[model samples]
Target: MEIKGLRKIEPYVAGSQPTGKNIIKLNTNENAYGPSLAVHQTLASFDAHQLRKYSTLDQAVLRQALSEQLGVPANQVIIGNGSDDILSMAFLAFFNSAEEVLFPDLTYGFYKVWADLYHIPFREVPLSSSFEIDSQDYLVENGGIVLTNPNAPTGIYKPLDQIEEIVKA
Candidate 1:
């Protein structure tokens, strides 16, 4: 039964997980091989007591480290649990205008989910036959544009010059 004043949403469907030995799980971006020895060592030495407390919301240490490595100010860095979290925040923050956002049709599926969830209009520009993003397609009027470098699933990377052209448009 449908409830009054309730928001209905079409959930994002992820790729299937096939179970078997020797199966490499590319659908979920899982590494074929297990974590490196350094990761294992770090986990082995982790303090279980820390789990009882929540981590800092600002993530100052991580942000500072990332900023130092990237040569940017700590205030300019925004960290999230993952790219999905960051992208979701970005969609909500920047795609508030009535104009439609644009992204590649064959890009990450989460873009559509976030757009729908936030009630942001969007359009999917088709990729070229070679699975390359034609920068010209995104040159048209748009509220915003999202491009995944070394695009997901296809693993095709658009050149920096082409990306700059889209940004300039």
Candidate 2:
């Protein structure tokens, strides 16, 4: 039965997970090697009892540490579950305008999904013949821009100066 006023949309289809021995999965950004010794030690020493309680939303301590390491102010640091969570939050916070958001024609598929989910207009600017972002393309009027350095699938990294040019445009 079709429900009234249902928002039907195409969901993001992640890359297939192949199972096998001695296989490294890069599609999902799975670590080629297992976690380092520090991670193992941390997990082993983790207090399972703490799981019963919810974690603090502010994450002040972790944010402060990250800010110190990155040489940024604590207020500028944002810690989330993962890049997906951070990106989702960013989409919600930004990209509210009549102008269309601009991103590469080939990029993480989630960008389109987020835009669709939020009802934000977007345009997928085609990459150069060499599969690199043409900063000139982004110079046009846009609500916002999302450029993934060391882009996914293609693994092409646009130079920092070019990115700055686009930002300053």
Candidate 3:
């Protein structure tokens, strides 16, 4: 069997870099400040012997710290490589061969791509004229609904209570 169609996919083009040494980087939303003092201290004093061990990506200590910070159970918390890892795991859990996923047209551009790659149905629900999703619209039909909290370039955030209600319903 010949593997084909891979070439048809468009390569993801990331944002550009700063031209000069003096240019303050603005494209990627990384922290301008250095790593936390605790993180720095931990890494600086990390034992070399531990490097020989094989631990799963789900490191317990980090997960426990995050769970404590979020006030949620470690089982409920998920750590990922980045936003894409979160998307991938969610799709894996919420979808299968015969399921449809719904997403807002205005949010994360990469969502539809993931659905396509996974062979899951992807529906683009248009936002209201003001470019915001009413919870009612998202609740209608979806195996899972994907949304950005503070939204995108506009940076508008919906209330948490409303988001919780939509997800629960």
Candidate 4:
């Protein structure tokens, strides 16, 4: 049951559980609201039998609907289980075995953990004086890079222009 030289694994820690039924669920950082009425209606209208099939893979029709709602082209959209999934996909698509990934020292620790799990090299770039992401700090090419917006706990959002500059670079 034991694999030799594999004991360096760290445990995953989720936010604390709630103690009361009616207690406010502020722990997970989920928006303090429920799904839209239309979304609820859509769920109620969902056909459970769809699950019996392949479920249309990524469900292009729903993706198109999201594109219309967000005013973005379908080609520009990417589907993922969550941001973590998106991060993993980016690492896979943008990085190679010989390349490295760059991420913040104070952001989601999961990024580094993923890098290690995948055996991808990575560098931890430092945060700014005000805990901001300075894109200019990244100097490597042909490597994956990650940025967690509105970085958790601190919840401070960086400017869109900064992200634009990073993408442009």
Off by over 4 Å in 1: none
lDDT of 4 by residue, 1-169 (tens): 6788774545556657877767666646555577899999999999888878665667688789889999999777888888789877877777786766788888777777677777788888888898877777864573767777787545778788877777777
Q: What is candidate 3's local distance difference test score?
A: 0.77
lDDT by residue for model 1 over 21-126, one digit each (tens)?
8898886777978899999999999998999999999999999999999999999999998989999889988998888999999989999999988889999988
* Of 2 and 3, the candidate ranking higher by lDDT: 2
C-alpha TM-score for every candidate: 0.92, 0.92, 0.75, 0.73
Q: Rank the candidates by TM-score, best first.
A: 1, 2, 3, 4
In the range 35-130, model 2's lDDT, one tens digit per residue, is: 999999999999999999988899999999999999999999998989888999999999889999999999999999989988889999999999
Tell me the deviation in Å of residue 54 in model 4: 3.4
Provide the lowest-lDDT 10-residue window in model 2: 1-10
Identify the leading candidate in terms of lDDT.
Answer: 2
What is the C-alpha lDDT profile of model 3 across 75-154, one tens digit per residue? 88887888788888888777774546777887777777778777777788888889887888877766677778887645
Off by over 4 Å in 4: 1-11, 44-50, 97-99, 139-142
The global Cα lDDT (0 to 1) of model 4 is 0.75
Runs off by more than 4 Å, candidate 2: 1-3
The 0-to-1 C-alpha lDDT of every candidate, in the order given, reads: 0.90, 0.91, 0.77, 0.75
